[model samples]
Target: MTVRDDPRIAMLSVHTSPLDQPGTGDAGGMNVYVTELSQALARRGAQVEIFTRATSSAQPTKVEVAERVLVRHVAAGPFEGLDKNDLPGQLCAFTAGVLRAEARRAVGWYDVVHTHYWLSGQVGWLAADRWDVPLVHTMHTLARVKNAALAPGDAPEPLGRIIGEEQVVEEADALVANTDAEASDLVADYHADPARVHVVAPGVDLEVFSPGTLGRPALRAALGLPADDRIVLFAGRVQPLKAPDLLVRAMGVLAERGEAVPTLVVLGGASGRPTAVRELEALAYQVGVADRLVVRPPVGREVLAQYFRAADVVAVPSHNESFGLVAAEAQATGTPVVAAAVGGLRTIVEDGVSGVLVPDHDPRTWARALADLLGDDVRRAALAAGARRASARFGWDAAAEQMLKVYELAAQVRSAR
Candidate 1:
């Protein structure tokens, strides 16, 4: 707000571009976070530019996302999709591209470099050094944390990524976390200095995801969903860590018991690795619930809001989540969420209030919770009301305000150094 706090942020999201679509490829919450936060920061009077690896030749090298928020696609590796594990090998190339971009700008083009994920943090280290600025990093997901809670068939994270993240933890001038628990993880697991870690929660767009935009019947009709069917929606990547299979298993349970099952629609694309959709289909056939399960590709945000509005409840059964933005967006649309009690989801979904939190990842528990909520309109209505009220308290504007303070801290640290 003051001239002294006008941070010229050079955001680094090396592995995934903010211009990329969410719920597909490697672009999930982190991409949404960067895209929204940068725009919000720009609205609050900061000049921002995002730097990301160019994923394909079709995309232009430069794009203007907002009034003063520009996204620069730095050519690093081949202009094609590469596995996330292989991205580490391209760090030097990415760093070179970043420095080349900086060289083209004036000396004060960027006053501070803010990085998302460890891949970006790796690139941010060199950028911060070259620009003589502070580095603030957000580890959206920790390798060790995900490895410890791998889903049924999910592979453990490699040792190399763990080492890379540890180095980033050490090098970052300040670490930003989505929740207090995540902040504690940095201190306990990564040995981050307590004073250097800040807890800054991500936000949802109220203008787009607000409740009461459309009636459920009309919205479902627009999507061609059966009017008689009670829809249960799941929106995110189809990866095992997200536990899309868990939702399928719950549907199977409902069918086996001869109880009327709500139509389960899973909307998302494959993540880094192939999801278990095929295996889930086989399981659905084995359990006689194939007809009740539907899987569709991810939709745009506005269409996604319609899907959220059409649903009786949204399920988020992830094995691990940094903040569960999908859950928040759904809740903002007046849909109750049934999410796993993990990470920031604990705070996002108020157990027995806005939504129920199943402590364990068992399918039976999820099935019962879904069945009860679907059968009881009174309880679901209460939670739906609570969901809208609770979500109104947080938005992108609030997140941008908090991040400005974190930027000031990073700037202060740079001056001290």
Candidate 2:
């Protein structure tokens, strides 16, 4: 039987929108992770409820994504799009709002609570304490990860997340990590009990992202990509930290070599980062590859699949990614990837097998790798086949089954307590 047979799961994903829209600034991985995992869990006969702060006054009382998966937007304070680090004081109030939302539901609605980030961990812990439910926590990104990304002098946050994260690691029934790297980081940095942590990699929607579904020529035609030109696609928000400029610079090197083929297609919209667009445009002009660059506005899932299918390759040049949904999605579409060798991308993209991983900051090295991969159709075909094979292992069905194991463990521990 699935954990939903117990009919009690409350997911706390505050500070990020539901899977419907990728939130600004933070990684889109968390929102996708929660949504896909919850849906997967529900498919296994589990009742799952996801909670996020309502962004609009006209939103429905509850959004039913599936038969057993429901998303509830609890009423919180103003300023709809505030980042997590800026939402600490508002969490307690949000927690109260969640409790009120729950009160309106039937009794025994939630027996176990799982929270996404540290802020949501605090809120979930509060609800868990009051409702006497077991709390399971996932720290999608840690403070140390933030420290590694920031400069020596610039403080990312003054209050910090160590204390609240420590509480979740120590008190929550169990802590789940999306990768072994994250699990080890939790134990080493926060002194989280090694016995209390588990690693479950995130899953991709294989059904929707399958290869034959793309129809490359049609998709390319739809996107205005030339039939003869190779296409390099990049999706996700336009942000400095994402290192989008790195991709533009890499393409510039390819252009300088007179080997630039297949227009570089950028997906996703600017997230209040006006400078990022100017930086990319300036870099395109600097490289003299402006004519070969195409920036497609934000696209929904259907259009995104077309871009993935139409592309010769997808590039994920993140400075840090806890788990790479971009790489996974590209693989699911039977396309090869060129990614930065960091975080979860390292785990997803095998160096020469599934796709290519280049050094994090070296644009020339990235350029060489991209050129080599895109130029050799034989290698590209092999990588494409391998990527599709590797992606098959990450079906949401399997991921959801594994998550139920975590839920079962949490419930067993809670029952013992």
Candidate 3:
């Protein structure tokens, strides 16, 4: 395989619009990653095109983000958004739209087809084979790893979504994992060729998430928190997998002992999975810490920054995250995080440095970690400062440069084939 001239890359994000609203089904991290990566790649002299389903009627057919980066909406299903589990049936139609659109292009065809999520891999695999382009897949979540880490209730039940994911891993030419854990899962569960898997971590926008700009006073007033109240926050989709109940249970433990319990703010929206709002509310009531819990819907990125800034500490107690983008965002905002030591969170937050990593599924441990951070001002300040320094390692510019290397490698492989 040899490197060649300027490459045109087609990024398949088939289920959700690359430019769609965040926190929606399959639209949070993957949407951010694809949109950010494509734009950054364009800035670095690559002709990039993002292909996604037209999930909204208001979505334009073609969106030009930069001179070299474009988002072309492929007609599939209807205007309403579909879950990734049901996306395979729509990929054939999406492929047809992509083929038609590319036929009218004046320049080079897609030298590399990069896919985000399993559904996109299904389409990319077919397109790569049909057009003789190299196929690169980014499995935002793996069914094998996710199924093993499922909450006690969600496990034991057959997950239809796992079937589609398995098909993608079995077919794709290359797998781009966000962490070593995901890379291990792909090889262990699906027997993917080890040579074809690449570990490329996700990146955060350092410019937007820089320090000292968050308006904490205004944000605290909006959330109705007292100036003196210690606030520990969790921000992400309000789904069962996110384990908001665990945070409520941990808060309950602090309340039971008559210790100083920090105000627990759960900021997120009802994205894909069944909303766990009632379960979280029930846990709060059962734990007798209803007054300490705050459940609010998603806020804008600026307000989100304020929440991150105002927090005494942030918590991400997910059962498992493929890549903990929230942890990175929190760290970027100079907020200390108390996350479960699992998945990509291991890489994002250094234990006892940027934040504390509690054992997964252990409410007592979570409570202790939360209590430790809330109790010690000096320690919290140190962690916060460390987070600011550590977050610089995940700059989007460096991430985009790494992706260019991957694209070039994929293009060289495609040319050889």
Candidate 4:
């Protein structure tokens, strides 16, 4: 797998757009990862084209996001948003469009095809077979892993997804995992070939998310947060797996104890179940901490940086995460995080170092951790100062270099086959 040449890559993200704002709709860390990594690859002299299902009628067929990185929007399904569960039926059409796009180019246009998510893997399989290229797949969150971590009152992942993901795991020429834990999940749960599985940790953009860019007190006042109250923020999609309600319930614990509860500021768009935010609102009312809760939609990266800087501590209470990008982003802004100690979060947030990690999903345990981090200014400040240093371990340039190695490995394997 050592012989190397200039590689042309076909990046497939079938269901979501890399241009979309993360933490909203169906876009999250996967979008940021693909967009940032592809840009990095392009900068490193790789010919990259990102293919996504066109969700709107107004989008141009091709957009040049960077100097050589192109986004080719291929129309496959209806021009309106459809549930992810119903996306499999459209993969055939997406695959046709991808092949047609490749047909317009020379025979050796794409040396490797990398797909994000299970839906794109289905299309990548067909395209890569037709193009005679290696297929590398990334499953951001495995269906089986997510189903096992379903929050209380949350619906389980569909059976169709579980079956599709299983097939993707079996068929991919190489699987790119965000962490060793995720790689283990593929090996143990789906029996993925250990030799073909590569654990390449994700990277954060230090340029966009850096420390000491904003004044915390002024930004908090601008965002309408109380100056004195502790602000425990959650900035991501509002879904059952994200467990925004758990943060609200933890606030309830502090409220019942007659302590000044940390204001749980949730900032993101409604996703997955339509009743996600409403369900959280209802639970907040039931817990009698509704007054301390604040929910807002997504914002630009600059404003998001402000929110991160203003926060006393960011809480990532997801049931599971392949990698917690928001935790990394927040840490890059010099804010400590209190995250659920599960999946890649275990690697992102070091206990008693950059941030505090809560072990159990129990509301009381989260309450205790949040209270301790919020109450102790000296310890919190120490974490805040060290947070940027922790985030320095991962940078997008390094990620792209590692991915180039994966591409070469996959290509060498394909050549052997």
Candidate 5:
């Protein structure tokens, strides 16, 4: 059987399950990336079996998330209360489960193994070596890249993670990056072989996140948001890396300037820390913009699209992102994004076109950008139109096609070795 003709894939996402809700605990864009990409590959005739650590006991051993796609929950340690930092210790147990599952099947059951994140890469390294299949890894976020742009009071990624990522980069037959910048980082920072690194941009679900039929005013009314008030939306985990606190401070800057402070709607939950969301609220209160701040839990994609449509502009002030999924999704919904100029976000948002790109995380700078964009309806409309066009460059089908090619290359590399 040819690689293009329905290759069976063993996909590993060790830290976060595809079925978990994003914007909460451990789950984020990486979860969405895996879930959506798997379905896209399945639609293209690939049979994908995703292995994720079981987070809850109630979860079945295997679940069919989409036709031709199965999510296998491997029990490694305690289902709950295991922090992400502790996951490295459970790699041996998780690897055992993956090998046992594949052992039950015939030899050569999986054509290739694709893993997301460094933790999964550790497991994939073993599984791929045992099965004699090519290993393809996507480092959703690199420890070095994140540590270089660490937010205030945020801890640097542990040394263990950095070592694990470097090892994975060395061993993997193919390394997938969400942007060219990331691919360059792999080569320059991690000293990865340039020939093995591939750039396959993650895609947005345009069908679910498209511009709706109703106008912003109508959408706001439907969402129970005040129609007359200007709205700025922040959708992601309330974590230091995401820089939601920067948005609150920007709101404070706007208020202090006696400008019309747009309601800053934060749509996400705490991540890493249990009190993250509450702390964000406290910051908003201290900034004297608490009344203008609204915190909402992250919702499903369909409902999230509604929230995107209801806002005048979407703010993505992340300190770093491998790929800014929220910015891409908002642009797909015809909402202009004001995102920080960092990592993949620099590629996702087009400055003065689809959205404005802030060069720094300064609250006053963000306030000025937000104020100027919100005050000018003509510019906002122009950007909204450009946002849709810019977002068109990314699609799941296109991403899947590119990924299939990468898989084929990985297979060839493994065979030659």
Candidate 6:
């Protein structure tokens, strides 16, 4: 199939802006995925414009984040205090803003529409139909998949979301999944058409995340971390879904066993709830690992790479992950990951090779894994070497090349219909 030349893309991210800082307030891997993917697409000659809901009045209506990538912030509901749950009520307004923006442009300005998350998919459904363009949707997280793996005391995803996702699956010209496992889930759980599903693994910025020349002790000192103490870094939102509590509890288990306890570094801000960070701190206190716990807000990508490099092991205990970006980034920095053997983590971490994958979320199991890895210097060094090799498979350039093909496929399907 002949690929179209530089297809213009209208990228929709209604719930969160690609400009937003990841690891805080509903911003996570999805934001990074959109930002990096757009930049990569642009580098390949694609002109991309991302539309997102305006969270602050101070933001400009449009800003060029990269050479060929633009972010347009559309006003929907009140900028402040509106969460993901509240954004669904504002979809109509958000969609209207998007349509109005396109109406100002020449006819056929956008060749295709690519949307991130379900909320944006809802907007893309109508915009693509109205504009006669193909729609490609990436359901960063699925409602049914997440609900099925909810953490203890975590609320299930709303019924409204399930219905919304179903509609998007039915309407989208193509559905992008982060892993083959996720593609299977889309077909089995969402009952999506197998022909429409495309598995495109996301990539890490190896230039930014690669192992730096600085050694661990020097990197730790530069990052103001304890040079001599072992560090187990958990980089994600402090939420039930992320399972930060399990790490704290695991620290307690390590202490109980009279084993050497590594300092637990929690790097992220409150998400889902305003008091999530405080709650995590309280949990650390309850587990008697408060002194060993360090809470830091999220940093930019370069600094985050340093944290990954300084750590002995990065722990990702999320209840579910459509894709484990944190684990991949850590591994890219030559840091071994200790992740739960679930969803995308299973694909990212190679047990006894790149990193160890705990079979379950048991605190004792995590504690043992952490202790064993931290204690075995020779094994850890071997895994670090393997990690760098393992992470080499994913690159934004390759992901963009495949995505361009998917865009072409979506266009073909739309034209056929």
Q: Best-fitting candidate, measured by lDDT? A: 5
RMSD of each: 1.6, 2.5, 2.4, 1.5, 1.0, 1.1
Clashes of 1: 0
Q: In candidate 3, where is summed lDDT lowest over 10 consecutive residues?
A: 152-161
Supply every candidate's count of residue pairs whose N, Cα or C atoms clash at under 3 angstroms. Answer: 0, 2, 0, 0, 0, 0
How do the residues 1-417 of candidate 1 rate in per-residue lDDT, one tens digit apiece? 112556788999988888878887788999899999999999988989899988888889899989989999888889875878789989999999889888888886788889999988989998898877889999999988888788987789889888989998888888999998898888998899899999988999987887866788898899988788878999988888998888888887888798888888989888756745677677778878889888888888899999999999999999999899999999999999999999989979998888999898998899899999999999999999999987986788999999888878877777777
Model 2: CA > 4 A from native = 1-4, 23-27, 79-81, 150-159, 272-275, 415-417
lDDT by residue (tens digit), candidate 3, 223-286: 6776788998888877768877888888888888898888888887665455567667778999
Q: Residue by residue across 1-417, what tens digits does model 2's lDDT show?
A: 123454568899888766555624554768788888888887777788898877678888689988889898877777465655568878877899889978988875787899998888989988987887778899887877766775223356454587778887877888998888888888898998787788888888877788865477888787778888888888987776567777788878877787754578888666545465666777888977788778766676666777899999999988777888889988988899999887888899987988998875777888888888888999999999999998977877887777778877877676677
Q: CA lDDT of each candidate?
A: 0.88, 0.79, 0.79, 0.88, 0.94, 0.94
Q: Report the lDDT of model 6 for residue 75.
A: 97
Clashing pairs in 6: none
| Ten contiguous residues with the weakest lDDT in model 5 | 1-10
Give candidate 5's TM-score. Answer: 0.99
Q: TM-score for each prediction?
A: 0.97, 0.92, 0.92, 0.96, 0.99, 0.99
TM-score of 4: 0.96
Comparison by lDDT, 5 against 6, better one: 5
